[model samples]
Target: MKRLLCLAVAAASIPVSAEDRTLEHVLVSVPIHRQESNSVLPVTVITSEELQRSVATTIGETLENRAGLANSSFGPGVGRPVIRGQQGPRAITLQNNTSSADVSSFSPDHAVTVEPLLAKSIEVLRGPSTLLYGGGAIGGIVNVIDNRIPRERIEGIEGAAEYRYDYAPDLNSGVGVLEAGFGNLAFHLSGTSRSTSDLRIPGRAIDEAALAEQEEMMGHDEEHEGEDHEGEEHGEEEINNSKGKIANTDTDTDVITAGFSFHFDEKGSYAGFAVNNLNNKYGIPPGAHEHGHEEEHGEHEGEEHEGEDHEEEEHEGEEHEGEDHEGEEEEEEIVRIDMDQTRYDAMVHLYEPMDSIEVVRGFLTYTDYEHKELEGSEVGTRFKRDTWETRLEVVHNALLGTEGVVGLQAKSDTFEAVGEEGFIPKTDSTELGLFLIEDFHRNEWTYEAGLRGEYVERDPSTNAASNEDFTNWSASLSALWQFDDNWQTGVSLARSARAPSTEELFSNVDAMDPEELVTHAATGIIEVGDPDLDNETSLNADLALQWHSANSWAELSVFYNQFNDYIFLRNSGEEVDETAVYDYLQEDAKFYGVEFESSFHLTDLGPGALALDLRGDAIRGDFKDNGDVPRLPPVRVGARLSWTGDAFGTWVSVLNAGDQDRPGDFETDTDGYTRLDLGADYRFSFAQERELLVFIKWKNITDEEIRLSTSFLRNYAPEAGQSVAAGIRFSF
Candidate 1:
């Protein structure tokens, strides 16, 4: 690694073209097809080149380093993006302008199905996009766009292939894309394969101090250690304490997609369809589900000791009878998940479908998804969801000096979960929404406004709880002013409402006996949902200022939100079967934050050009009566410096996260960390505009023991240690 780094730096003398770091003039599809800089909303777009430089197994991990974002990772297999201080249902994830229709929002351990490596670009829209996507996006929206169903004609055949390997996780990944066009017909194909071994860490997997404190609170001591010894003597297997690496953290995934498009007229009218299939299998960390078992064993320790000798004799007599059975059981005991999904999407676009209508668009999609959690060889739980969604939009001609689009969306879902840990009952849900947005330009100021209304209904399989219905409304307005050539300012305000999700309303535990109450193994807690929950509403405001030049630009934004009837799972300060009890509850809350980003490019720096980028963000959340919110990300600041020549470029970055001290009710404080990384890339241009790019990256160069405050498994699993990753991409 050292030699490679030296060679990359020493190659600066080679004559090459200076790399152009200018922002592309691409339109962000998620926000009404407007350029990010000109829109009233705060948007961040990651182009294809930037995505290739840094892509990970999960979308959250891939975008975690971006300003105002964090990864709520579950071991090395699962990661979901947490925006500002909100996650789950509040922050929506979309693929090509529609919901991915995955169960990631149901639990932190579930993975989002959208693959970042296969995307053409990614758009992150901050603040309320509720008026367009849904009320669920009261926090933000992340849309991954791909050209699987191309709307434009391609000249001929073109493709790209890449292979990457990482040291810490022993990961191997390969991706390929191929596209062809003939006349007015176009076709696309893409696939990716990835696999990994257990993750390497800086030290022990378990935080001994935190574990000891937890055990003490559970009234446990060394006296309970004999329980595990007895189990081992009786031929039962035990999970050993992991050192230097996190056990059961391996993963394997595969994805394939095929699409076709046909253009009907010369005026840019087209129809397209695409199909995608994905399969993944991954393991959960060892300590995630062991806490409840330890607490239960501690509670029974005294009783077991009284009959220790009698039990020993009984066990000795039956040892031979159960040995074979125990061995068979041992083969299947590691906790893992196997999931698959198949999705079909179709869209239609028409130019001048009617008078005063510039365009008419329609989109439809259906998804079939299922997953099973396995304990050893036995299925512990199974989750399945079938979703159908459709949307229609009309882009009308300017009316009264204003341009706008009106849209209608409808969706239906059938979801089921069965097994030991199926806390929420099966349910059917439906939603219908109508929305309209318009923009007006006048002199140096541009103003935009939108409004949306939705109706939602839910029906469960059980009669213990009746069906529920809700009606919600959302609206937003913003103004942008370009008072000078190099300066701009924007202000936005929004009021959004979201109906409660199925899991929040239908997680049933009242029917089960106290001793047999169902528990969510991933979280190791007993959760009870409220059937009478009301819609959550939010009032938000934002202010931003930006300055730009030919090679330099800077932007700063501040935002505040006040929520009514904010929904959260709260610790009830109670226990059942030695497990803590948590209830879905509502409270008024407030969140405020600031984010800033700046980049400067310079010339005449030792045979090459240099660029500097700086970023920082901070947020605070509190309840009107309670203390702080739980699992909020810490304040972070980072900087990167890069040197670019005609053919070779290298960069170095340093990021520091402040300690998280206000870990709301029943949570633990987390220490801060500083991480350093280095990377380099060299391009080789060939004939026919074809090119090959080789890149190398060194992550966590210092091997810091970093624990993310946004993760529930932080105390049991640390992030990966020092590692090197290298890859080569061939584009034609």
Candidate 2:
């Protein structure tokens, strides 16, 4: 702890120049846009400039290295945010304050449909946003802001385009975007495409079974089909994967968005509408296929038969008998995730500074999402989700000596699944909520509080499933005291409640054998659900410190959370249908974590400015059984030396993670490794009011073999190895 304080003190020594001032980040997830320094919640904002500097494949990976954040990486196409050691339904992803409305939270293998390539800004709000968002946000919220909803009218026309590529995975990507306006009307259009081959790793950390599972699903027996497993050592055959390639981990994606807006004569008033369509198809790093995995588990309930789909579709009369032709034949039957989503959003802003209110805002969105798990060209587990949401807020600049916002939010969604591997049952979920938030200040001191009440219902298609009508309430209070011009400290307390998700209440997959366990297609763990589960209520506390100026800044945040009736999966210590049996259960749990971030301007070396950046985060969680939480990220610390000039920028950083020894039940320890990254960028203006920026970055420069504690596939697939990425982008 003393060492952490010393680091903060050192970071506080940076000097600030008035010429290149850093804009303090701000938060807009709330009804009103406010500076981070004024918000009670711990917020991390990543500007568009920062996004352009990093080579990120998924939205979750883009912010995974940030303080108090982790990524649940499933191959290269899937990355869900894990904040403060909480994930899944506990945390939520949003697109401009609306839920992403994807099935990413349903399982780790499912990818999020939102594209980060065209994002204008991103925000991570730590702690509960139960009032503003919903019970789905017991952990936090990640909001990606895009230009789909035009906010201003251009004089003529303007646009930007970017093309990017990487060597390690042979990735190619590009994006085109434009905006035009006539009088009070404006329009926006954008398109993005990305494709990549199999991912590359440093070593063969992958297991042999993972590589051979695809062929096994294709109805080929190694001993009889001539692909003999001759030198099996202790049941672990190293499949020559040392070639440094993680097969079936490739991806292809395309996205298009259009929007229009009409501005009124009154300032701060506008109405806009947008539509976005996303299509993505990505491989699921071989191995998790089971029984040809049909989409409907109930089709053959209580049956011991698995993988009968190959009964007639054996190679489709393709080539056979030859060794080379057979090898290509088996590799062709890899599994992939095919997904698409379309969303429409309409929003309005009105400015009428009356005696009681300052402004009124409304936003509505509709989303249709679907994804199919393909096992050798046949749909395995098909999932679909449709959602509609709307919110209205009234903001008051001063109400009884306090600034306040009152809002009402409603949402409804239907989720359905079919196919052999379908785990969760069909269900309809709806919510209605009301919230009131206020902020008060007095001479360098600030106090904020919020209250929320919500009603949620979960109805399943099966009459045997549980139906719930839950009423939940949440409250939070915070006090910030600025002791000096450059130093400030604050504490926040919150009590939030989250209702059970659909999967936790109605998942009842028909295992291959009623007496044995069956592995889940997504998690590779057999799972069951309980219809009697209850809502989880949490008491959270946070303490934070900040000291900042124009060129230097330091921050430290610590948090603790305790929950009652926490819904979690528990191993039954038994086998069903030849797979491990895990059932949903309720228990008491506790989670705690600390995060530190600091930046110091070292010295102005020649014509450029030099700075030192240091950051670290760690967390631990346990249930009443004293068992560690599953897939928790390990402790990490890193530092970077950066330089900035008139038209050039460069940075070098080293990130290190500690070994994770506190493994969950039935889990093994994960070794740690260090990674180095170097990046540089240059900007050139070829025309008036137009500039092109080019950048190159080398990630994992040492080519270290690494596994993340937060990944479900840590044992079967390691993180990407050393890769060189370069890109060019232009704007006018």
- lDDT (tens digit, per residue) of candidate 2 on 1-732: 333333321111111222322675556686654677777678877777777766377877887888888888778878888888788888899998889999887777788776778888788899888989989999999998987878666678999999999987788999999999899998999999999987888866354343244345323354245533233321221122324776777889999999999988557578999999999998876433422221110111111112222211221232222122124434445668899999999988777746677778888999999998776667867889999999899998976779989999999999987877777778999999999998898898888899999999998887566578789999999899998988999999999999888877777733335643334555445667777788889999999998887778878998999999888766554545434455777888888878887787888998998988878877777877747776777778888888888899888888888788775644556777888888888999876689899999888899998888787667567888999999999998
Q: Mark the 10 consecutive residues where model 2 has the least summed lDDT.
A: 296-305
TM-score of each: 0.89, 0.88
User: How far in Å is the alpha carbon of 545 misplaced in model 2?
Assistant: 0.4
Per the 3 Å backbone cut-off, how many clashing residue pairs does candidate 2 have? 18
**What is the C-alpha lDDT profile of model 1 across 1-732, one tens digit per residue?**
121122111111111121322544465344355477778787877778777777888888887877677788888998888887788888889888788999988877778999988998888888878888887788888988898898788879999999999999999999999999999999999999999988989877766575544444434455354475454554443434466788788999999999999998888889999999999998887656544211110011111111222223222332221121144433443678899999999988898877888888888999999999888777878989999999888888878998888999899999887887787788999999999999898999989899999999998988778989999999989999999998999999999999988888887634555665677765556667889999999999999998887777777888999999988776565667556666678889898888877777766588677987777777788888778776777777777888877679899888888788766644457889989999999999999979998999999999999988788777778899999999999999
Q: Which candidate tops lDDT?
A: 1
Q: For each candidate, how many residue pairs have backbone atoms clashing (under 3 Å)?
A: 5, 18
lDDT computed for candidate 2: 0.75
